[model samples]
Target: MSVWFQSTGRKMNNSSEGQLDKICESLSQAELVAMIELQLSEVDMLQSMFPDPRELVVEDPSVLCDLRDFAEGRTLLLPPHLDLIINLNVGKGRLSMSANLPHHYPAVQPNIFVRSQTLNRDAQHRLNQELLGYLKMLQQGDLCIGPAVTWLQEKGETFFDDHPEEVTKSDANTMETKVIKFARLWIYSHHIYSKVKRKDILDLSREFDLTGFCLPGKPGIICVEGLSRNTEDWWHKVRSWNWQKILCKKLEENELKAEEDISKYRRFSVFEELGSENNIRVKSGGFHVDMGDVFKYLENHESGYVFKEYFGISGRAT
Candidate 1:
């Protein structure tokens, strides 16, 4: 079946028409049309920027409705999922979320959640907080999934950089019973400016046989990826340091907790830009530390690192 639309001045394709009919069964045509138009506009905007617009996929909630009794929850099942393929300077990431409208949307808020592996409990709570903020600003009865997803994509890079996790965890029951667990430490410290403090972290990295990059500054980030046990040990040693004296301490203690497995990076070594003045260096068979232009030499000799898996998405993964 096809429907003629004066807006596009063309006959809608059979597949789209059928989709629209499915939505119309549960929602008023006016409301469904408005929702569909908003979604298509989002797709068009994404296609303009990305090589493959299909990466930004939106699922029809009506399909999920067939499997559940909505009356039990008294919620409108729309915007089942928004899957985004995010590419940033830090790395490639994916984010997915679900927004279910309450019986009285705009008056009663929608329940939204993050369904991405890249984010943990704290991160999910933070994202939901931001989504609620958007809800408050919107007019009563306004559809919200579009704006919430747009905000997520814009901020995804920071999310991944701050809370990067392994894309896949090994199963102990599988034939490959040897499971390698790793953890990523995003160290934020003001003491990094001091030569002594800088060396302390580098020394710890060598002692643990971990590989990661450090961007030295008053409040800089140290991205480390390595075995979970060693990473936890390295982290505790860092926590015990005299941070107050150096004026460099963790901003969020909870964010620094170790034991999480990092399944992404294949090997350990810091990746740095060749010309940076404060680039961390390796010496004595990658044991000692230098604070100069030595990454050029290491880059030539060190094996390149590989990302083992793509970022994980939530809901029906695209």
Candidate 2:
């Protein structure tokens, strides 16, 4: 009787194993289908939101073709993993975001990297850390890139303000001692609508102890006067950024006298942004500076002669 019961138990176990295999196979296929659908939907949404080719660039062009084929039912194979870069014009700043989505994403979080021209090293690190923290708080299957971008557009500027670059006392003293020659540089750009560029201009001026003003608009104008070497270094850094066109329009250098007050030789005491109140108006795309106001400001500071050098005109009349 024991042998009979044992034989029946073995047969029952074999039948259960066959049924379990079928169930597992079914579940695996369903999971794969679901994953594919999720990925396709997300990619479509992302592409739709950032319609510009420049704004949303695909790292691997083949992946885009594969996705297209799969979506159109021309292939049974799943689309390849996707790597995307999104260029964003966040509130007065610019951000370049890279997102990598694996085969099982939405089931897993994407790897993300954010780059900015405006943020300093420490600020960049803090921004990335906070973004990682934000991802951790989200559910595993939740879509995060959109929210991440929203967070950046809304709060990224805070990080810039929060992490002010520090200049050591020794560095400041060294910079002061290095100022044997006083120099002023006038830089011109096609346009400067980016807040990131503006912030960088401000930060670099502070680092170099430059005193000047930036007129941001259709024809962006920047003037920085300080130690010759520092001004050169600052210009080198600024010109390296992506721009339609940028040029050192004018350069003025003079040897400092022993009793000369740097203040008397400098037109501006601090770096500042000249805006609408200063006769610079924002039009649909860029800024329009009433040359009269600019000439007036420069004339007040005894630096009005630059108008002729910059515009080839004697004054605002021309």
Candidate 3:
């Protein structure tokens, strides 16, 4: 059916007789009108084949993010806690069709790829091959990509929403996963920063002073550096915990006991010094009785050093 509109972008007069008369006069003769009508029909068919903007659920959160990041012209940094997963390309399909079906492939989606500045000729050839393939498909109208733009717009709104509870887990859950997958990049860039202690992928979060929250069922760990070197003073300057207070009390008790031992030793040394010069000795800038000589004399010269004979517990030197 032929349709026309007014300058204001609405349907023209709805009277069928007037519309038919207009179309017939515009076409004039038979053959020319038939061709024009056939061309209009093709356009109508094209509109039906074109997709209305909609989102397909990205089953894998990690893949979903990687595709979006690529679209945004950013690098993907998956955490060590998250396994490297292969996903259907979501950003490079063309505008063509297959045997009656539009050119589309599962796991093959639209995306952008950047060329490495330092790539060798051979590497460049491989890259060119892939990029050319992307362009060629579009030229031949063989690739029909899904609506990633609308999907990202909806997700971004969900993340920044103050009332986040309204968003379902399937929608909001990926927000955190994408964070760990892309930010707190140590877990993504280096291997030594995190090590697997057991079978599960553990977040060595404490080592990096990171706070990681893993998805309920997904394999990736989302982490953020709650406290970094620049921001540490504001956080760790907090008051001590209960265990720290207990430790301080124990240290005070030990210090008092050490002081008591020194006092008792001082009293014994004073008494010995008052008795005779032979009993006097100096240690650590203070006077002390030569208790070793006195002990040997008492033992009738059986032992000269008398360290064992003069032994005392509780801060005594042997």
Report the number of the highest-TM-score candidate: 2
- Model 2 lDDT-worst window of ten: 1-10
Q: Candidate 3 residues 50-74, lDDT tens each?
A: 4332222222346434433433446
Q: Encode model 2's per-residue lDDT on 119-140: one tens digit a residue.
A: 6544565677788798778765
Clashing pairs in 2: 92-195
Best by lDDT: 2
TM-score of every model?
Answer: 0.29, 0.44, 0.13
Candidate 3 segments whose C-alpha is farther than 4 A from its true place: 1-146, 163-318
lDDT-sorted candidate list, best first: 2, 1, 3
Model 2 has an lDDT value of: 0.70
What does candidate 2 score on TM?
0.44
Residue ranges of candidate 1 with Cα displaced over 4 Å: 1-36, 43-54, 59-93, 98-111, 141-143, 160-318
- Among all windows of 10 consecutive residues in model 3, the one with the lowest summed lDDT is 243-252
Instruction: Score residue 98 of candidate 1 by CA lDDT.
Output: 43
Global Cα RMSD, each model: 21.3, 19.5, 33.1
lDDT at 8, model 2: 24
Error of 2 at 220 (Å): 0.9
* Alpha-carbon runs more than 4 Å astray in model 2: 1-179, 258-260, 279-286
